[model samples]
Target: MREVVPWQDGPDGDADGPLTPSRDGAAKDIRAFDGALGPARAEGLLSALELLRADTARGAQLDFELLRRSQQHTLDAPQPPPFRSLQAFTKGGREHYGIDPTTRAHFDACQAESTTDGGRPLPLTVRAARACLDVCFFHPFDDGNARSAFLVLVFVLAREGVELDGVSLLRRITFQADDPQDALTLARYIDVHLAETRRSAASLGSQ
Candidate 1:
């Protein structure tokens, strides 16, 4: 089984402020991780990401089924994993505290609200970041919740035609389920990566 770590900021510092490519070196880390993965597993992940990209490009909304399919591809396991029936925890002991009996119902409601633009209109990055946070805090799966959350974030951004070139900050960090500030911080992180990606693309286009 994959080792799980607490979802907390690294020693580098808090994730606030404008994240610069020079400061975070996330692009390198992402590239390194991709390179280190064996060919078969790497191809599997790429296929999964493409599936998500295609679905989002076609205007599919964020939903549990979509996530399930994404996870299925991500794991490449014999049978598709189901939503975790048992409670999950992170940070060593911080329980996800999701409603166990009605977890599926809660997930359904969350997905519905995520795709719709009701109430106060939130920016696309904020919505995408929040979706990732939800999956993190919900801890919906037994083993692959983190990967699923990342894919969900990617799908959210892809739907808007935005892709991040750097995903260093997005991974290996934990968030508090009830912390409003964490939500804002995640949104900021998304914006930082998005900005960097746009800048890189523009630079390449000019070259």
Candidate 2:
């Protein structure tokens, strides 16, 4: 069942923060495990985990290098990097809308919620993209909100083995969708698209 986390209305009708499994210490531990396992083993473990549609924290538990390797399964080079400082990413997101401190606090609150429970399970591919898109659209930061959120979605989902190109999803959704709602809907469509793509690729290999 989807865990209950109060998602308040984001600024300008956007959705609020994450309310799933916490992963701060767990994420750190995973990184540690990755380091201990070294590159090849870490990558193998991550690849194995991707085949399981489990939780985000379970997957994020891999080491940084392993996480990076897992990311390689889905992402190309020049990946959008996660924000170095949480404060910087949050500040940029809030300032973009010229929001006041109080409202900005709420944005921070939501951001904190996302990280609170390490992360959530993005079982379906499109949902993963949608989560990040929702965060970016609702919390369009002045600095790296879009890029940061995109990276988060990419990395987080990659942990689960949904190796999608963040930029490509953004491009496809923006170009295909007629409106905002349409855009969000298009993101959902990616799930079906990915499944079909994988199926076709497998069939081609068999042939």
Candidate 3:
């Protein structure tokens, strides 16, 4: 299958830079939001994330069906399953192309690689980030693709017993499908949140 986004090799993709949050302010904001939501009902995206987290904790394997359920929970209506029949596109008019026989095979390969640990030689965070990016670029669902992608990332991390303290950068960020740097950037984003969360917990313990 042809690539949806054309990747250009460069220093950005060549070197694995220091893993840090792209925006420190966003991480702080996410922390504040999480702190404020203590003991409250998680509605909408939060609710769906919580559900997916629980499933992951229960050893749910990451696959297409899990993604469909995530999309179903994310949307108000469940008329359409997670898979998109027609051609979809990003908000910036990046066409996802149509899902034909070739597309299905490509997606299946992605799923298999994502679930199996021996499939890729990359670090866990990078692998998880790649899965998330795959969903974003693939644009599998007719709607809620962004949300679905976010949940997939969370599921990947949770499956490995890694949950972020904050998700500020994970949300509201656009990734270039063709850039290999995007994968590393996302892994760094995850690391930033995890570190911050650990720091926060340590502070609480000392308090």
Candidate with top lDDT is 1
Q: Give me the candidate number with maximum TM-score.
A: 1
- Report the error of model 1 at residue 93, Å: 2.2
Model 3 lDDT tens row, 99-156: 7767765875785565546732455566667788878877787777776787788777
Off by over 4 Å in 3: 1-42, 79-82
Q: Give the count of colliding residue pairs in each prediction.
A: 2, 10, 0
Segments in model 1 whose C-alpha atoms lie over 4 Å from true places: 1-31, 34-41
Instruction: Report every candidate's CA lDDT.
Output: 0.65, 0.38, 0.63
RMSD, every candidate, angstroms:
7.5, 13.1, 6.6
Error of 1 at 52 (Å): 0.7
The sequence of per-residue lDDT tens digits that candidate 1 reaches over residues 119-140 is 6545666667767877887777
- Of candidate 3, the 10-residue stretch with the lowest lDDT total is 5-14
Q: What is the TM-score of each predicted model, taking all chains together?
A: 0.77, 0.39, 0.73
For candidate 3, the TM-score is: 0.73
lDDT tens digits, residues 1-207, model 2? 012212211111112122122222223332455447566544543443442224354544322233233344323324523322223324334333334445544444443333325454223343444455544544433243443344455444444444431233342243211134443444455444344445555566688
